[model samples]
Target: MTDAFSSSSETVLQRVLEVSLKSNTPVDKLEELYQIKATCDFILEHQFAKVALQFPDELLGDSVAIAEEINRNTNAKPFILGDTSYGSCCVDEVAAEHVGAECIVHYGSACLSTSKRLPLMYVFERRAVDVDRCASSFRELYPDSRSNVVILYDVSYAHAVKDLVTILSPEYPNLVSSELVVEGERCYSPGFIKRLNNDSLPPEQCDSQVIYQFGRQFSLKSGSSITDYSMFYIGEEGATLRNFMMTWNRCSFCSFSPATMTGRAESISVNRALMKRYYAIERAKDASVVGILVGTLGVADYLTIIQQLKETIRRAGKKSYMFAMGKLNVPKLANFLEIDIYVLIACPENSLLDSNDFYKPVVTPFEMEVACNKQREWSEEYITDFRRLLPGGQSHVPLADQQDESDETDVSLITGVLRSHNLLNGEPAETPSSSSMVLRNQTLTVANTNSAASFLAGRSWRGLEQKLGDTPVVKAVEGRRGIAIAYEEEGTAS
Candidate 1:
């Protein structure tokens, strides 16, 4: 019995440390996987002296070896960057700049959002896929050869997309495969550029030939709309799939996991998620104080979005605060109890924060726009990217035409209380005069101010308070000084 128990414990321990049991990858294979040669060429071509190599947590194991290889191949100094200041999917331009890195080479899965300052090179480590199995799974899910299907995939399995398409195109004529383009002139599709340049035409009317969501771009049949087609995703379920689903919520989705070698129809609906976002927007309208949380510094136009959000909040007659703390959690946000709602400006994939774990509700920039902009209206279409909310983007709503709705009085559905929008106009509440004072059950009850500062003032522990001039001052006295581990006074006594 004792021997069996020990053996079982050993098995569990091995399972827990299974990642360590994997054999080290060969140098030659690692070079190919990380595209070390290409990275070195990019650095040398650009004449970058200091190069920053950014890797996600899962890919950190091979970061050192990859960095060394790059260092040996090129004259540029290579520095490994981990614990990214923002989402790992984005290039850590902030951290790269800290070391004065001239360029950033990001490894592992990426969101492909454009970086602001530094040049970025992505090394999506190639992962093996059973092409035959994938083709077979595709056929099973989409049996009709003429089905209007779009093939979206993870960047790691991007190498196999060509072969998969080659095999399926012969039979499936209406198949469309999305390409992940990060940098260079090919970054934005023609349709995307047209939409950005021309705002007079509605998005749907602005060339339905192509569609761009997040960083993935694809073209549809000449006359067919994206809504007319079904989406077929190749990769494990993750942020990529979730973003895809949210963006093209109208299309039916089916995903095939290479790891599991199984294909299934995606039944997860974005309707519930959309409803939650709408609810957050409604809550924002009722908020008197808003917190603008900077969730990313790498994505292009992040600063512009931050400024826009501030201006929008100000125009709404609400108090606004900006925070740039790296990474967000309950404790960090809970510290700012005065913030009625937090508007997270981050990459699309990281924007929709789950509010369940948070003390205060967190919302995306799009939702914030709808809540703050009285001219903006809620619709079936939802935008996750902050860039689209910029001045010229399709979803951009100008604040110039906004009507003054502050004087309107209505009841809050959330609080079920009669609330006045005028309370959020940043005007100080009037103090009751002594002549109008009335007794209420032998206790004084003041009218609710319905403001964040008023809420904080009512809290039991409103942070440390300095009673200036109230407490008597004492003469200073010398105290024993020593290291934290062992004090000098204690050592002398012993």
Candidate 2:
């Protein structure tokens, strides 16, 4: 009944369609592929009672096609749990349309919220945007959960799920009635997983950190991996996916951005395009921000992003501080991103301290946490950060209006992961000392004081050199100094 990609909503989609048609196969082909895969998968695995289809809110057209394709390709028919009434004009239709059989059913209230008891299940677990909640709320399905509660994880949430699933499975033996459905070939390394879960935190984690100075922050653990560039591997047992986090449409023309020096828009057009159409995120502010870069091309890619951001921030003012994975190529990114401060997320590749890389001040995960904590409204802590003024309020947020709403005490699933290790990092650096990129006598600063990164490293970690080989601190980035972070391309600053 509803029209496909309309002018108001289909501008982006239409452009994508145009590109796909001339460059690749028709958009419909993707759905055909899904239909085939789904049909085969279902036939091979559908010995169970029902099937649950999970995807983001963007897939809503061609529900019938998907069903038909599945039935057409497979020996038998399978039920689909999708409702056209609950459409989210996205490419997910590529999967929806081809599922062309009547065996599919999302029979309730046209919407996911309204949908009723129709045998098939539709799962959409986007946070806050949909308070409807049932999309992926997994717990004991009760005396009647035999119907395989297939939990599907795309690249974004896949990595996070891998970690959380491991931590939680032991506790939810009865809860997991069905097998876990992790798609998107995003493999993560065992080292990263082990490192993230190494620290001690409660199940309902309360640790989120200041990404950099100037109020920028992100979760230590996002339920999603977000980036899916297959070139970016997380390691063994680590879910691997292609990194498609960069948005290119705007990058081509950005001159004021510093990243342009490191990564030409021409080279990163693919990164930008993938992010724009599929999964691009930008800052939400008009203020200057700080950003950090890391690893091989990671710094280069992020630098280009920061440069574009700076061009936009000048008029607005939200500039980002830059840092790197290790000390490797910090200056290349720092200058491009205009990072006022620096922090090292990891030295796995030696980006921070290497002579080949740019010079940067020291930063540690703990310092970054301090900066992030500063922005928190501290809505639900039994204790407040205001020093007994409120007695049980351990929160000190940067905003006035968000104070109460955030106090609801809703800790995200990833919050616990942040609490374990210091998600924040920072360390001071002298301006152009002797060999590094010589500049005036300015010292690098950490963006946030949210948590005490300096203090955290003191309490938890001691010898950075002893623990992590190749990536030494103090020389390039001092141990326990601190680290900074940046905003996404969309200006969706936090």
Candidate 3:
């Protein structure tokens, strides 16, 4: 018994040393990229019975190492998940559910879409940055400027933020850093914001505000307000930068790359992304068949959003089809030629698909709402995350229990808004005898083709004549020049 105890202790110590050596750089440098201590602390605190540890393909090598550390320190069982069904950035809830994981610890770059069944904890990838060099570069770029500068950064460079502020404090007295605010029951990830439009919350809490920064506010005053503060982002130009620009387009912003140690103005790129989004929104308005691409099922409240979309499309007198494939690629979606537009129900990061290369225009849920809802005027306030579609609930509730407002007769389908309308083209639209109108909404078929329905109902239509009731068949005469005059020859030949 004594020998066995000694062997086990030595083994544990060996594992600890191995991990320590692997991450043996300065504490600041080691923690900058991935917060090993914080991750373990979170796991221990949650006391989750089953935990799913997700890592991107590039970071998969560190999975065993991370799991071992967590297992050694806590009682939670860590299941290493790989090759997400959808975009690698989005949380793979399907993978987590396989192991019956209660929560997910996502590592690396994440789209930050809300989770469905499993709550998620994100460990953003951190890259080392030379704080002094960045501070020096800023001084050179804006030497004459005296306004307060707000430091915004990609999740990957979150660790370098503190060092940056410290290095630049002496030179720039008003340098401020922005931090994301998270308030929810689930474990909050770095980039994800809480659901904004949840109706269950009281009126005071129902207001949608995704990004909250704790830096100086922009202002036009002689003194610096948050509005007047110029943005100094520390990351490469990509989705995060694009989203940030769209969120604060009016403010002056600059993109700085810690990897390359270079900076560039992002006004042109920001405008271009906004312009493309606006164009896609306008094009979706004319679509007859809208495809609701179920890009993710694991996202919390996705089903609610899907049902809402179906009703919204129907009210707008447009046919909607649901497509569910883990990954939404252009090649796969192009197969559905009938769909004029596709609204991707994906994480906020991957939701705004660049349709420049796609055969059909793909828009986000926000754009879909704008296009399908006639009364919805275009607004600068844009929301792409699925959680923002509805309020967060305590637990997943049955669809039947949820209240649906579409049953109300006073609602107007043409305008896609709720309002009382007694007449349509000077005729009573409904007089308690409008069964057809009611049935139209209830029995709407997936396929709008008349021939397909007729063929299924034992009827002979032109193309399907061979399948059903007898219809005279014409024989082809390849060598005959007067075959066009078949009607004249029919009576004579009989």
Candidate 4:
């Protein structure tokens, strides 16, 4: 926390308890809500002497109370972390390091990116939703639904899932629940499923099919393959929904909003995003200087992705620079006029920044890889997880789909769906300026060769010059045609 917001650990705990009492929140549920018991158990199991408690802005009110409870129950010393360097969703490992804490216990909504150094124990916030009504809406929306109905939700709505299952189990026979078998924090998307393979299946999934759980385990009544299952998401139109649609575009999907109490069929709107993403990819290929924005340091495997991106840019014969700012805003980036494109290495949730209003385009690390890798082809598959982009995690592109080396030059890299077409007027746009198409000036200049001291040593820095009218200054003073002297009298007097 900042200095202004700082309070004694005991005072903070007392204030949090007061706030908790006014809300009529149960004291017993506090342990489950914050996962206090599990977090303490984890500390004991690991025998960590020092533990850090990280909370988002909204969760700060409960931080002190949680820390006190942890300190009381376990032998570990619990310390509270205030503000974070980047997005609060990421574990504030740097803050923990300041206190010499061993690990972090993160609370509230998370991006679920793996922590690089400090091991993170995430306690996602669970808000109560009307499961009975939500299930009724699902039942009425799709009467005689297929056996394969996979249920997914935002981490916030994770609590209602069990009740939703109990209500819909009788009507929907094959209700599927998923737990991510992959490493790191679980993302809010179905793309994690594509990363699933035979070798990566968890212990419970060993004998079962190749299907891995997305969030938590929802045991199917009977064994069934992942075929025509309709994905029913209990969240909003966010990153999770975008990822879910991208992975299972062919399958029927419906999103039921617990807040609105409304259910609607998700059409090809998700497809529109695919086109936008492709357009961004095409634009990235034309960029000369790419700014790699360190969107997140908290997500696991971020450093690996940054290294891969730099190498990719180098291989493509382009230049790249690294930037690290906790938060990214258009104005902050606009200062760098030389940068043509910015590739964000952020959490998938915060990734895909729309640079339409920006002076330059912004892209993701995945897009950077696509633009630079000659072996990569434009595909429908988009990777949001950086861990998946690692060497072993990289998905193999089919040989038939890979582009040949010779064809790379002949193909128009900038030719995309938006080319030659004007969105405003229903007519062809004028040709782009030559300056826009020209290659960046890669020539480096020597500072000493054009030094002011060397040039002005012989020349006079004064007003009106010479036989000719006032002349412009030249680089070298060796052979000058015209001269001016404003301080002639002062020089003579001195």
Overall local distance difference test of candidate 3: 0.62
The alpha-carbon deviation from the true structure for residue 439 of candidate 4, after best TM-score superposition, in angstroms, is 8.0
Badly placed stretches (over 4 Å) of model 4 are 1-29, 180-227, 394-407, 410-494
On residues 314-425, what C-alpha lDDT tens digit does candidate 4 reach at each position?
Answer: 5565567789877677789876666768898887667756778888888877777777775667676776655666777745321222233222232335653222111111
Q: Whose TM-score is greatest here?
A: 1
| 366-482 per-residue lDDT for model 1 (tens digits) | 898887776678887888899998989878888754344444455667877655443434334432432222222112222243455556656788888898999899999998789
Residues 1-494, candidate 2: write the lDDT tens digits. 11123212322121222111131324556543233454345344544322223232344343444444544565354433332221221112222333432222321111111111122322222111111122222322222333222222222222243444454355444222111221112211111111122133444434532111001112233242212101111111111111111211221221111112121112334443332221101112111133544322211123333343233222222223444332144445533323334433321122112222444343322232233333332121211001111113232222222223221122224222112111111122332222322222122222222222233333443434455566556656534332334334335345
Give me the overall lDDT of model 2.
0.27
Candidate 3 regions exceeding 4 Å error are 1-34, 169-174, 188-227, 267-269, 386-494
User: Against the correct fold, how does model 4 do in TM-score?
Assistant: 0.70
RMSD of 4: 13.1
TM-score of each: 0.80, 0.20, 0.66, 0.70
The Cα local distance difference test for each model comes to 0.75, 0.27, 0.62, 0.64
Residue 314 accuracy (lDDT) in model 4: 57
**Superposed Cα deviation of residue 47, candidate 1 (Å):** 1.8
By lDDT, the best candidate is 1
Candidates ranked by TM-score: 1, 4, 3, 2
